[model samples]
Target: MHMDEYELEREASAPIDMLETYYRALGWEYERSGEDEIVSTFQGSWTQYELRSIWRAEDQVLQFLALPDIRVATEKRDAIYETIGLINEQLWLGHFELWSASGLVLFRHAALLEGEDGATLSLQQAETLVEAAIEECERFYPVFQFVLWADKTPQEAIAAALIETQGEA
Candidate 1:
C-alpha cells in the first residue's frame, strides 16, 4: 500500500522516518546516522556546519544541533561566553552553548511533534527550523572569529556581527 508523505506513518516508527523522507524530498545531503538520527551538512559564507537531528519517539521531541570545530583558547572562553549571552538574547529561536571539555560551541533547537494521533512533524516545520538554525549560525559565526582571531572584546564582536536592517520599500 502506497501512502502519501504526510500520512505515511501516523503512529508506526519514530519521527526520523518522516524527517528522512522530508530531507530527500528537498534534495538535501543527509545521511541516516542511525534508526533515529540524521546528519546533514550545510555551508555558510564563512564555513560549513554539520547539523545532526535526532528523533526521540518516546519523548515526542526532535532535537537539532550544529557544532563546528572552532579552536577557543582558554583565555578567550570568557569573551565567548559574554558574546553568546548577548547573541542568545538577540536570537528569536535556538541558543548557543560552549562545550568546554571539547572547546566546541554548539547551536541547539528542538520541536515537539506528538499529539493524540501520533506525530505531527511536517516538512515545512522541519525545513523552517533547519533554515533558521543555519541563518543563526551564519549570523553569529563572525563573532567567534572576531573574539578568537582578531582579539576583539565580546561587545565588539557582537556589534560587528549584528546586521542592521533598514526599512526600504
Candidate 2:
C-alpha cells in the first residue's frame, strides 16, 4: 500500500505543472477533459475508482474527487445519506457526499491556494491531496457496501468498517 517511492520521485522531479503529473508519474490512466480538469482511474483492493482533479483558477482552488461508482437506489439513499454523514464525521480530510440528483457517492477535497500561488501546487502537496482522497475512498468502500447490500445501519456499517484485524487471515 506504500507508494512513497513513486510519490517521492515525482515530488523531486520538478515543480508540478498540474496535479495530473503526479498521477501520471504513478502510471495512473488519465486524460485531460479540459484545461482545468483531469480524469483518471485507480484500481483498489475492493473497487475501481474514477479520480478527477479540477483547477479553479479564479478561486485558486484545486479540487479532487474519487468515485467508486456505486449507485444508490432511491430507497437506499436516506440510509446512504446517514451513512455518508457518519463516515464523514470520522474523516479528518475530505468528505463523502451523496450526489442526490445522480444517486452517486464520492469523496471530495480541495486545496485552497493564495492568488499569488496561482493554480499550481507543490508536487508534495499534490501527492498528499490526491493520495489522501484515494485512500479515503478505498478505506470506506466497504462501509457503503455494508449499507447497500447488507442492510447495515450507518452506525453498524461505520463500526464494522473501522474495525482493524490484528493479523492476516
Candidate 3:
C-alpha cells in the first residue's frame, strides 16, 4: 500500500491527502517531496523549523519530524546526549535526539494506526499528532539551546526547563 496507490482506493483522497489538507487549513506552506513525504516549515519564538512527514501505508505509520537549523557542535554532542535523557523523561509523546551523522538535532513523533478494527486515518488524527509535535518541539527548544549555546549542565537545563507554572488568577 504505497502512498500513490492509497489515494486510488475508494476513489477518495488518501490519508496523505487529508494530512496535507490539514496543514493547508493551518495556513502553512508545504511541498510534497515524494509520493509519501511532505516538508513544511514552522516558526517558533526561538527559531524556525523544517518539519517533514512521511506516511507509511504498509506499516500504517505517520511519522513527523521537526528540525531546527542549529547543529550540535562536535564538542557539544556529549552535553546534548546527557541532556536528552532528562528532556525525554518529561515528554509525553516524542523525544529529541542528535542525528549523529549530520550533527543535527531533531524532534520526532509517530502516529500508528494499525490493528484498530477497520479504523482509518483521518484529518483530525493527523492534525492532532502534528499539533502535538509542534508544541512539544517549541516547549523543549529552549532546553537544547541551553545545552548547545549556553553551556548549561544537563541537570541545570532540565531543572530550569521543568519549573512549575501558574495560570492567571
RMSD after Cα superposition, model 3: 5.7
Which residue runs does candidate 1 get wrong by more than 4 Å? 1-14, 163-169
TM-score, candidate 2, is 0.85
- Tens digits of per-residue lDDT, candidate 3, 1-169, equal 3344334333324556766766676788999977688888889877998989888888878788888776988899899988888778888888888899999888888877665453255655776777787787777777787787788898887666656211211
Q: List the candidates' TM-scores in order.
A: 0.83, 0.85, 0.82
Q: What total of clashing residue pairs does each candidate reach?
A: 0, 0, 0
lDDT tens digits by residue: candidate 2, 1-169: 3446556555332222546667766787888876778888889888999988787877777788889888999999999999898888888999999998999999999888664434446677877887898788877888899999999998988778878311213
lDDT of each: 0.78, 0.79, 0.75
lDDT of 2: 0.79
- Tens digit of lDDT per residue, candidate 1, span 99-155? 889778889999888767876666667767788888888778888888999998988
**lDDT, model 1, position 54:** 89
User: Which one wins by lDDT: 1 or 2?
Assistant: 2
| Model 2 residue 150 lDDT score | 98
Candidate 2 steric clashes: 0
Q: Which pairs clash inside model 2?
A: none
RMSD per candidate (Å) reads: 3.6, 4.5, 5.7
Q: What's model 3's lDDT at 22?
A: 62
